[model samples]
Target: MAGNDVEAEKPAHSLFDNLQGLAFGVIMVSFGISLLKAQGLITGQAAGVAFLISYSGGIEFGLVFFVVNLPFYVLAALRIGWGFTLRSLACVASISVLTSLAPRLFSYAHVEPFSGAVVAGLCVGIGSIGLFRHGASGGGVGILAYYIQQRTGFRAGWLQLLLDAVIFTAAAFVLPGWGVLVSMVGALALNLLVAVNHRGDWYIAR
Candidate 1:
């Protein structure tokens, strides 16, 4: 009991730790985004909105994603704190830049839709865990979800899942019917992973 308490009392992550963790999270998420782009698939949350706009408008995903997240910074700062808001901003910017560079860096020959969905889901989910553990996020809906979870005892993933349903529904009009279904699978996988693993009681870090 004493040892457990001591363990719980350990300090939050250092600057170096946060930098590496956030970088890892951003890279993983960017790779996942690239995979989704390769297959012409979409996921949920603000990223989904960016994908939809990018696909239809022929605008860049990074630009759209960054713009979509602008409003959320206010919410994040007011509710979550400046530290969290700043870290989230950095993570979001890094993802935007990396995802833009991803196409120039490498191209995929082919990726099966189902396989891509699962793999992309896993990558994003794991990466999100890293961000959450390090007191940051991919921004946009993530900031709202995390704030709600912290204030209301609601699980962030479940909240995100609910929001994802709305996003996927909108996706139906933008994408083919089958594509929307497959995207939902990816969203489900990602949200379920977060739901199970993102328990606040299990982690003491800020």
Candidate 2:
């Protein structure tokens, strides 16, 4: 490629933006774990899979979760382009690192089922909205959601709901009923948060 062409194609992202996203990812993972432990609720997709492995195999949930998600990062890069992918990788890595390390750093883990669901929903909803605001994503459902958006221009949030349904359904069969129900409540909260917060036309950059 020509030098000028390559230079023009480069993606730009500020350090402040990256750090902000990293902070969001960390808090989300930390709270997510708290919610799960509190309600005995499982998460979706790779997280749900990780919960199963950790619950059954006596492995660290973060370790299992990271390993399961590792294989998909490359595909995420290819589809979403490098800058967004890198930011997402940072978010994913932060989530993994914190999930593994947070328990050692903090003491609270117990939570009531209803409260756990509320916190999990809020954490994911707010975190995801922040990521979207910065023109990046954590690259799980976001990756699939983008593809569907490109093809259909439909609401990616709805796509996520459908996808989460499938994952949570499988989780229900594997996990206890109350846990599954809590996850459902968490899902509802996450979708509502995204819908309410992500109106691009309404947002003004600070």
Candidate 3:
């Protein structure tokens, strides 16, 4: 029937709907990021680095996160398109605001460090997928890494690994040695979820 065909052709989400989805995704991510911060664990990218600085200097996580991501926008716009850049900006801003508001939201009385790391990983994993399906990226230095790979012949993964190494090294001073190791476990958890499910092959919303 013509009605059946018409219904099938409708977009799954309107533009406004997707924007809301993007905000929601970033909230979930910021919540997790804040939880991880409370535990003094690093996340292994721009966000992790922000957390590290926030811990050491007593600055707000939101400000550090927003500032660190500024440089990567140039790479994101050039390589990933303005839409992606804009969406990334939206994600960054939302997370920044949420990170600021998070402390007022609720303070954790007691959270086991390992448990907090695992929880942060799971939240970030799900949030990453939500952003992916909505056609946005959560901000990270990895954008610069991707741009470098495109221009030069280096792999983004290797570049990211190098950056992670530096982040963890700094984290060693901020957190206990075991906490640094658990941070790696959290990072692995986040990366594994993205690697396993974010292939375009697995998503067909377009």
Candidate number of the best lDDT: 1
TM-scores for all candidates? 0.94, 0.80, 0.82
Candidate 1: regions farther than 4 A off: 1-8
**Error of model 3, residue 157, in angstroms:** 8.2
**Candidate 1 colliding pairs, count:** 0
Tens digits of per-residue lDDT for model 3 on 1-206?
Answer: 99567657655868887877787789878988888877777787788888888888999889999998998888788777898788888888888998889888979999887778888987876786677668676667656654565467464445555677888888888988898898988877776665565554344454
lDDT of each structure? Answer: 0.89, 0.68, 0.77
In angstroms, what RMSD does candidate 3 have relative to the true structure?
5.3
Among all windows of 10 consecutive residues in model 3, the one with the lowest summed lDDT is 197-206
Report the CA-based lDDT of candidate 2 relative to the real structure.
0.68
Provide C-alpha RMSD values for all models, in order: 2.2, 5.4, 5.3
Point out the higher-scoring one by TM-score: 1 or 3: 1
Q: Compared with the true structure, what per-residue lDDT tens digits does model 1 show for residues 99-157?
A: 99998997988788888898998898888888988988895998898889889989989
Kindly list the per-residue Cα lDDT of model 2 for residues 1-206, writing each as its tens digit: 59567556556657786577668755775667655644557765456667777776788876777677766667667776787677666776677777777667766556667777778777867777677667555546665665555457666667777777888767766778877887888877776666666664455452
Cα distance off (Å), candidate 2, residue 167: 1.3
